[model samples]
Target: MNGVDPLGTGVPGPREARARARAGTAGPTAGWAPGHAQANLIAVPADWAYDVLLFCTRNPKPCPVLDVTDAGSWTTSLAPGADLRTDIPGYRVWEDGRLVAEPADATPHWRTDLVSFLIGCSFTFEGALDAAGVPLRHVEQGRNVSMYVTDRACRPAGRLHGPMVVSMRPVPARLVPMARRISGLLPAVHGAPVHAGDPAALGIRDLDRPDFGDPVVAEPGDVPVFWACGVTPQAAVMASRPPFAITHAPGRMLVTDVRDEEYRLTL
Candidate 1:
């Protein structure tokens, strides 16, 4: 089944072909699609694209951008044949800083004035952590990574600004340095731990509560290690109160053709 146009005619481009092939598939293709890249998706107005792109450039720790699409173009040449409109399993639409809806596909909301930005996700670093034998609680429990909005302000770029959001993974105090070493190798996916000991230092006052995703047991002798999360852009978009914005729901990343290792070298 090819991608049917709004008019009901089947489109025959490379994107259409891949969309037809990978349709209805869901979840992180991690371990399955070995060496394939996974991206974080942020779709906002074309007018905001440049400012947001600059925000990404300035705050590379949280918004490591992988690619940007021309206004209204859903096909990403950087991640060939992947259709941004429907490739991802879930999407969240925000209006006036509130979540309006979450849909499995965003084609219905696609607009010529809309532009897509693909950011790097920390999921790219999971392979490295697993390779080093750092057990991730969320992955073991089949839950999403826990995310918190910190009082730490991101360096503002134009109107794109907000508190930094960090993803927490509880590590044995002994393995904290190992985890940092493994994750630091991929800077594009948010390198190193922004906060390793007390969440209070980063203004994260609660450990049981998270602004996004599921919370996990820190366990005795386990220290919560935090990394600047890709979700930081979503927080910024909400704070900016853009007329319209779209982002992948937490854990539902935009899987790309770029490999995880590619991020290790200069991005």
Candidate 2:
């Protein structure tokens, strides 16, 4: 019901988005390929792979790992025939926990010792949310979703540790419950809203000044809703200082071949 908009939105289906990304079209992927499961990418050295896996296991909400690749391998079951190094629009290259480069194609930076993890992304459920009549302000405004680092810290695993990061979406007050329930069905993609009222409750001070992504404007009666973000791993990379790592640029994601319904739970 997504790529084709089963709700009769007449939106074309098929994941040509990856083709564009592979061809070097760099940008965030909020509404790129409807109905397809999108994922967050993070690759670390083989030695640090277990620590990252354990971290994701400990912080499932923020790091719902969909797939993990063998050392030096870029292919994933999530998207057959797709190359991890160049399929995503953009990538963040890190050295000693500090970001060193933002590359369109990570093939040059790819290493034989790196292992990649594909984490579930909130964008995967956006089609259902839209079909349910929930507004997507960032999509409507052509902006990336707003994300912030909170005071809440994640459970440490081995060498990986950091505060939680959340993506904020402004939903109409009356539709907040509907929004929560719809997203709740996709547990792999950070199911449900973590907070749905005051940003301060999460220690996020200024809505306009987010730690990552673009700040979206809210229409009248809209309330800010927060969801645990896959970017939490990147925050950990920044805080814990992994020797070397690569990640999908904030907001940009790996659009997998898996359908949105595959991860959906019947209510």
Question: How high is the CA lDDT of each candidate model?
Answer: 0.77, 0.91
**Reference-based TM-score of each model:** 0.87, 0.95
Question: Per-residue lDDT for 166 in model 2?
Answer: 98
Q: Which pairs clash (backbone N, Cα, C closer than 3 Å) in model 1?
A: none
Off by more than 4 A, model 2: 1-15
Task: Looking at model 2, report the run of 10 residues with the lowest lDDT sum.
Answer: 1-10
For residues 1-267, write the lDDT of model 2, one tens digit per residue. Answer: 223322123442335677778887666788777878999999999999999999999999999999999999999999888899998989999999999999999999999999999999999999899999898898887788999999999999999999999999999999999999999999999999899999999999999999999989999999999999999999999999999999999999988999999999987
**Residue 73 in model 1: shift from native, Å?**
0.9
Ten residues in sequence with the least summed lDDT for candidate 1: 1-10
Residue-by-residue lDDT tens digits, candidate 1, 1-267: 111121123333333323532575444322323345567889889888888998998899989888888888887755676778787767889987789998877888788888999888887777677777787777666567789999988988987889889989999999999999878888888889898999899888888889988878766888999999888989998888878988888777766666778778552
TM-score of 1: 0.87
- Candidate with maximal lDDT: 2
